[model samples]
Target: MGRWVCRLGPALLLALTAVLAIRPDWNEQLFLLGHQSARLLPAVFWRLVSVFGDWKTVIALLFPLAWQQPQRLPALLAGTALAILLALLLKGGFAVPRPPLVLPVGTVQLLDALPGNGSFPSGHAMASALLATAWSAHPKVGRWGAGSLAMVAGLVALSRLAIGVHWPLDVLAGALVGWGVMRLALRHAAPQGWPEEVAQRLLALLSAVLLLAVVFTAVKDWPRHHEEYWLRLVIGTGVALGGLLRFRR
Candidate 1:
């Protein structure tokens, strides 16, 4: 996986870079096309898709999986940390402007509030891809399952563009870096940091924290993000409780 990802990286990066540089407005035109096309899907659909990009949603899905395969945590966590560090460093280095800042007002189809800058590569896109890749390694998943996860990762990355926050270049780069980093991490996964039992306890504690955060967010945002309100309340509680119950057993 690592070798394949590394081999694919340069070619993919070069192609995307060439496309972006072919014309001054090429990136902008692509962004506009993606943003406009998003209107074909219901706003609620886009919003729901974007929800998967949120950390809580990802965690809610991963914690139980990680519990079942504690050894996988080292690679998953390492990949997450590495990808985040790279994304943050690049964001600071490039300091690219977000679509909202560059595009005219009312151009972005916003699902929620957005930040003003540091948009070289999207953190959300990277995170979703990395997590989805880790998820595909579960023992029961088949080839089709892996493909579905890949599509989910792509959609998560694309949602950043559909909602008009990130440029197409940003999404493309993020998704690639995400999958690449996960592949590298999985191939070189460090020895498990904790005993399986200990890891379960720690994961449960972390899930408890995530549950609290979900509740806070649901309350803080109220009717404005009602879907998330119910989602957080339900999934957050369920995942956290599942982890806790598993720990108890």
Candidate 2:
């Protein structure tokens, strides 16, 4: 499974790139299609699911998960960090306009203001894919667990479209970028005993910090008044607490 992803994921990325370059307008139709499909689901469901894709959620999950399985932590961080850097550079360089800007007014179902970022590759999609891929690869996880996480990741990507924030191409490219990077990075994720304890303890500390962040965000800051925001607060707080407890023992 991992072997196939390692090879084919990047190939699919390149293929998508070519398609975008050759028939740029093609994405418009796909975006419309994806957006339409997303609306078939309840808006509330997508709103909640979308929160799981946020980078804050990823951080909340990653540290504790790493404490559980120490070997993969380094490569997982490397892949995510690399994916973030690439997404930033590409988003800024391409400066692709978002769905709200491109489509006419009232064409999108906006949950929040489109502010402070160019749209191309969806950052939420990237983060979701990276974390999902990492979780799916966990040695302790079975096939069903892996498949479920992958499905959730797919929904998270779709939620970006449902909320009218991202184009189909943006989510697609972001998913590919993250999945491909993490899958390849796992080649170096083999376990090494004795030496990883320090890293594990640091991961525990990071988990505690993330727990505090979630708590503070949920309480002091005025909630963003959206379903996604509240959902993130609740889910993040829970996950952070769970991670902390796992490391504490």
lDDT, residue 26, model 2: 88
lDDT of each: 0.76, 0.76
Q: Which clashing pairs does model 2 show? A: none
TM-score of each: 0.85, 0.85
Q: Please give the distance, in angstroms, between residue 147's alpha carbon in candidate 1 and its true position after superposition.
A: 0.7
TM-score of decoy 1: 0.85
Query: Which portions of model 1 show Cα errors greater than 4 Å?
Result: 1-14, 21-24, 191-193
Q: Candidate 2: what lDDT?
A: 0.76
Report backbone clashes per prediction: 0, 0
